[model samples]
Target chain A: MKGKLYGIGVGPGDPGLMTIRAKELLDGAQVIAYPVKKPGEDGTALEIIKQKVDISGKEVVELLFSMNPDDEVRKRCRAENIDRICGMLDQGKDIAMITLGDVAVYSTYMYLDREVRDRGYETEVVPGIPSFCHGAAKAGLPLMIGEESLAVLSMAKHDIGKVEKAVDCIDNIVIMKAFASIREIADMMGRKGIPLSNATVMSNIGMEDEYVGPLETDRKYGYFTTVLIKKKVN
Target chain B: MKGKLYGIGVGPGDPGLMTIRAKELLDGAQVIAYPVKKPGEDGTALEIIKQKVDISGKEVVELLFSMNPDDEVRKRCRAENIDRICGMLDQGKDIAMITLGDVAVYSTYMYLDREVRDRGYETEVVPGIPSFCHGAAKAGLPLMIGEESLAVLSMAKHDIGKVEKAVDCIDNIVIMKAFASIREIADMMGRKGIPLSNATVMSNIGMEDEYVGPLETDRKYGYFTTVLIKKKVN
Candidate 1:
């Protein structure tokens, strides 16, 4: 018996943002898996789906994968954990690993996808609404016009210089995973004449905690933060 | 009673890609509006949702809009149609206009969003799955790494040179709406020493018609297309 793996993106924390495909996968899958930073911590992806759909029906699997930064530790844990996941698949369990935003962009699920592929298991990825798209939509701004260049950057390394170069080059820039480095981004945008007022910062988009407005200097950044800088179309 | 207009995105002809919020808007709104090139033509947005959702409970509104390059004709038609949509809102109809992909990414809904704002009618936008994200996911490629830049472009404009410049400078490029000038892009990408075999082109992502593979020169481009050129990671 062979089992299939699904990388399903549930979109940013708004349940309504879950694509019809994601919902179907959730309802039909034999096992619904989600990553948790530690036990009992709220999952950004699971929270998004739980809001609208009753996920209690599926055989839920919680994969405790800490986001701590030890490369070797993560690799080892992921390998061992994936082997366990594969063991269940060996029992003909159709599994789904739900994620936030699009699974291709900055998703940890890629590691598992690679594992499944290397093990000769079939896998498919279901796309979801990206947080940046939601931020741009809420801002009432055009992310790409006739020929505008768009870019998405992660500020995890906290490299202000590299981020500045990106902002300098792209016509429209979407910075994601940028909580720790929001101040540097804001300052660079201001100095580059990008106009802080023109930029929009959306935190927890599409959820009750959703906040969207002119870039605020005082707002503390979080892992879920996204900033979209587009030249104000006059 | 003045009703509000919602510009919602129905992602890339896949019912599963439609966000949970987008589904709610599509179902609960008094009118579900969508754009079409000609009267009675199958609307992309409506067709996506009609598969999984029974929208028979909602009144359908078709907004006939053309994307012809003729400036005067397009501008005039857009203004008139927007006026008509606004009138529906004024008549106490809560209308949800569905656009393919995210409403803010090179989407016609952005124009409507601006027009509605300019007219002082309160409007909100619900974002959907972006085709570029979907393309990357379907192709099994990561869009960007930490501090890495990703550029998205369209090939219709003569400004392909400018796009090339950005692509040259950026780490990854996702070109959308490139069905018409794929050869030119392929040529430029090849000149840049970016392996065409490594470059993934996805069309109709998330839909049954979705196709993803390495760039093949013999293949003809489709209307809904995305080309991703990713830097080889060490």
Candidate 2:
């Protein structure tokens, strides 16, 4: 019998936030896969599941991933990784690839899911709590309430123009991975007269360096940072 | 110490999709509250928890919530419910209010959370797997990937105009509670010359009569319908 590939979301760095299905699948899986910037580097997805399930005896597969802007490099690396993962599946090993948030949302596993499925392997995507929900919950803010509209955008450097247009129409906005462009976002909010008080900046949520507060344009923030902006003007 | 309030999300109808934190809190809570349209009505939130945790001997608080369009009625009913909840807290009885999906997104708990805090009560919101995530996972589609922007709008009757503007700017969009405006949305999609192939319509996800398919304008969807539209035009 062929093994099925599973993409599980561990949720925003909290083992408690992980769905029961995710933990259960990870416990039973023969091979565990997660992305890392380089070989030997620990990933957050692993740390999260480690807190709840004792995976000391399980086989760990560290898939090298790149956040580099070059399309060629990313495609080549992803292709190589999928080939390696497919080899394990060929051996009838149930491989479970874990991600930070919902695998359907901005996850590297999302790209690999289609590729693995095309190779004639069964695939399942297990949904998890997205980081933005944790940011909203920690900030005690409603992501949206009573017909309010929400726009979630990945903020790149100089991506202020798209944000401006979204701000014009969307009632509330959550900008994920704001580490690279947090200063630019703060500047745009300043120029547009959007209050910093309206923003909830979360960095490394549920981690040791976790910070949930107003935007600090002058200071640098760790990855896993998200800035949630609520339009109080309206 | 005053009794604390908890808002737990049971997740889009699948008991296994519920976060470990949500299930753990519910298991220990003495008073379990869930919203219903009328007294003695069975809510999906209660049904979801029943599959996982045994709450048969625990106290059940049925919060009467109306989907009425009238603002005055909603406000009056909400005020009464909050007052009753505050009284329970006054007696030092902990209340766990359960909601569908994340409590921070379009849940009645969002409104009550603020009121409960203002009355000197502690409130905790445990985020859950949103229905949209499950919809995307079920359809085998990414909600947003690689700098893509997502707009999540609650669609009301005659709300096609807002969606049109969002379609112009957002890369992908998820319209929650699309039952009332499904046909109008179908008409708008056709009028704008956008292909229906890019849309995934999910109705009553993970429940009996659950339907996931392309837009069928002729059929009437249930109240839990959500339409996920991808802007392939961009």
Candidate 3:
């Protein structure tokens, strides 16, 4: 029996937001695996998965994926993780690897996918509502329009210039994982004469404790998040 | 009594791909509205919504939105559609207006949104998976990875240089609705040596009789669609 692997995004946090396809895969999956921040902490993705269905019969695998992108450290971690996943697959085990957001958009599951494909294993991706989109939903803003394009960025400082470029080129922009870099982004948008009045920053979208408000805020949020800015006046 | 408007994306023909949030709004919405291509032709979004839920109790409003960008024509269509939607909302009606892909991503809902907002009404956007992301999922390709940016473009025929700029600036490029301009885009990517081998063209994703293959196919698909160009070899 040829084994198969699933890259399933559990969505940002709310289990209800999980795609029907993802929910089906999670409920029927024989093996469930996800990347965790450290060794002991339960993966947030697993928690999201549990909200959807019973994972009792599924074999849970913890794959360590360091957020830091140091070449040596990441390579070592990915190799070990891929080995564990590939081993399960080789045994005809159907594995569903849960991710936090959409698998194609800035997801770590891509690394595992590359490894699996390289080893001649079959792999498929189940799309999810990107947290950025969820944030836009929560914030009640349109990110793009006719002849308008949107860009999704991350927390890196270099992303600031890209945000500027997107704002200049596109109709709207969404910056993901921007909690650490919101201050700089907000400042840049302000300098660019982009009104902060309508700009929205949402953290932990779809979660019970979701925060949605004007981008310029005194309260600090540290979570998987998005900042949405629309150029057109609402 | 409060009037509410929901901008819901019905996804690309597959009812399963519709987000739970989109489904919730669709079910609870009192007024169902969508843009019609012509008087008698079936609205693409209407078909998707019909497959998922019973629209028996809801009022269906069809607004003609011809793709004429002429100033008078656009203003007149925009005004008429906006009036119809706002009229229902004014009567404390909960309205869910359907769009094909995500309402925030290259959607005509933005045009309606600006009109509604101009009429002094609050609108909430429920994000759905964009056509491009759905297309990528169907093709089993990742759009972006660590530190790499993604750009979505709808370029004019003479805008190949602009397309090149977008490709150069971003890691992964999704040229949406570029079926007419495919040869130009394909030629540009080839001239730049940007791995056309891995590029995939997906039209009508998640729909019945969808097409997913290399862009160099003899058959041509010119419709609501997207192209995924993977930036790096995995």
Candidate 4:
């Protein structure tokens, strides 16, 4: 029998935010698979799990995933990772793949999950709290309410336009990977007279050196950053 | 010396999906407050907490908030609830106001939190897994990836136009309170040549009689229903 795959979302960098199912799956997994940019260092997802469940005795495998700007390079890395994951499934190892935030969101586990399923291996995607939600909670603000609409987009040049379009329709907006386009977003919102207090930038949420404050373009922020824009607050 | 407010999210109706922090606050809460419609019945949020925590001897308060279409009635009811809550806090009773999902996202707790904060009481919001994320995970589908964007809107006649606007831009959309506008949204999606497979509706997520399936306009769904629309699928 081929082993099953559990794509568990460990929550947005918060160990305390991890679900009961996430902890149970990680604790009972025969093998642990986590994405790591650097070979020896644990990724954010693994770091979160470690804070709750011990993985010392488990077969922990660190897989490298490319975050290169080039599309081809990223695709190649993903294909190679899929191949490696399938090979493990054939060995009857119940592998648990951990990712930061919900796998249903932008987590790379979504792609891997489909790949594993296509190869006739069983897979389960366990949902967890996303960063934007946690960011809202931490910032003491509501994302949306009472007929309000929201748009959640990746921060890119194209998204700047989306923000403009979204502003006309959406009452709230959350931009992930916001560091690269932080300046433009802050300026655009500033131009619209949407006070800096209405827009919040949270970096490394629930992690060390976490930041939650008014939108600022002056300083550099970490990779895991999210910007939230609200039209109304009480 | 007023009581603090903890707006706890219990997670999309699933007991196992509740976060460690939600459990801790509830276990330590001096008074538990939950929204209820009928006088003698516990709402969905309270029922979920009952599954994990023993509220037998704890101080549990049931709040009534009008869901009537009349805006004035709803506002009147909210004012009353806030007044009642403030009275509790004045007594230095630490209240744990639990909601169905993340308090920051369309939960009634948002209004109460703001009101309580305005009255000078500290309120902490603990995020939880939302129904849409859990619905996507339950359906074995990804909400969005790469540069794909997502729009989350409440189902309404006005939102039908938002969907039309969103279809041209967003790669994914999630509609909450979908039961009311189910048919119209389905027909619109159908008219736009979006296959039913691209949209998945999950009702009573994580609760008993949970459902996950293609968008069906002819059927009736519960209050907790969420509809997820994906532009593409693998």
Q: Largest TM-score belongs to which candidate?
A: 2
All models: lDDT? 0.78, 0.88, 0.77, 0.85
Model 1, residue B82: distance off in Å is 2.1
* lDDT ranking, high to low: 2, 4, 1, 3
C-alpha lDDT (0 to 100) for residue A173 of candidate 4: 87
State, as a TM-score between 0 and 1, how close model 2 is to the true structure.
0.95
Candidate 2 C-alpha lDDT tens digits along A88-159: 999999999999888878888888888899889999999999999998888778898876899999876558
> What residue pairs clash in candidate 1, if any at all?
A16-B19, A16-B20, A16-B21, A17-B19, A17-B20, A17-B21, A18-B20, A20-B16, A21-B16
Chain B TM-score for all candidates, comma-separated: 0.92, 0.93, 0.91, 0.91
* iRMSD of prediction 1: 1.6
Which candidate do you rate higher for lDDT, 3 or 4?
Answer: 4
Candidate topping lDDT:
2
- What are the chain A TM-scores for all the models, listed individually? 0.92, 0.93, 0.93, 0.91
lDDT score at residue A116, model 4, on the 0-100 scale: 80
Ranking of candidates on TM-score, top first: 2, 4, 1, 3
lDDT of 1 by residue, A1-234 (tens): 888999998886667778877888788888888988698877778877777567777788888876668888877878877998899889999998998888877777877887788898888888887778877877788787765777777777776776676666678788777777777888898788877877778886655567777778887644578888876543
Candidate 3 accuracy as TM-score: 0.89
Q: Write the per-residue lDDT of candidate 3 for residues B1-234, one digit (tens) a residue.
A: 658888887766677778776777888889998887677778888988788779998999888887675879877887888888888888999889898877766677777775687678888877776777777776777787777777777763346676676666566778777767777877888888886776788876765557888877456775755777766756
Give TM per candidate.
0.91, 0.95, 0.89, 0.93
Query: What are the per-residue Cα lDDT tens digits for candidate 3 across A1-234?
Result: 867999987776777777767878778889998888688777888888787689886899888887665889888888888888888888998999988878888788887886887899998888887777677666556666666566666665545877777666655667777878877877887888988875788887666667888775566876666777778754
Q: Which portions of model 4 miss their true places by more than 4 Å?
A: A69-72, A156-158, A190-193, B69-72, B156-158
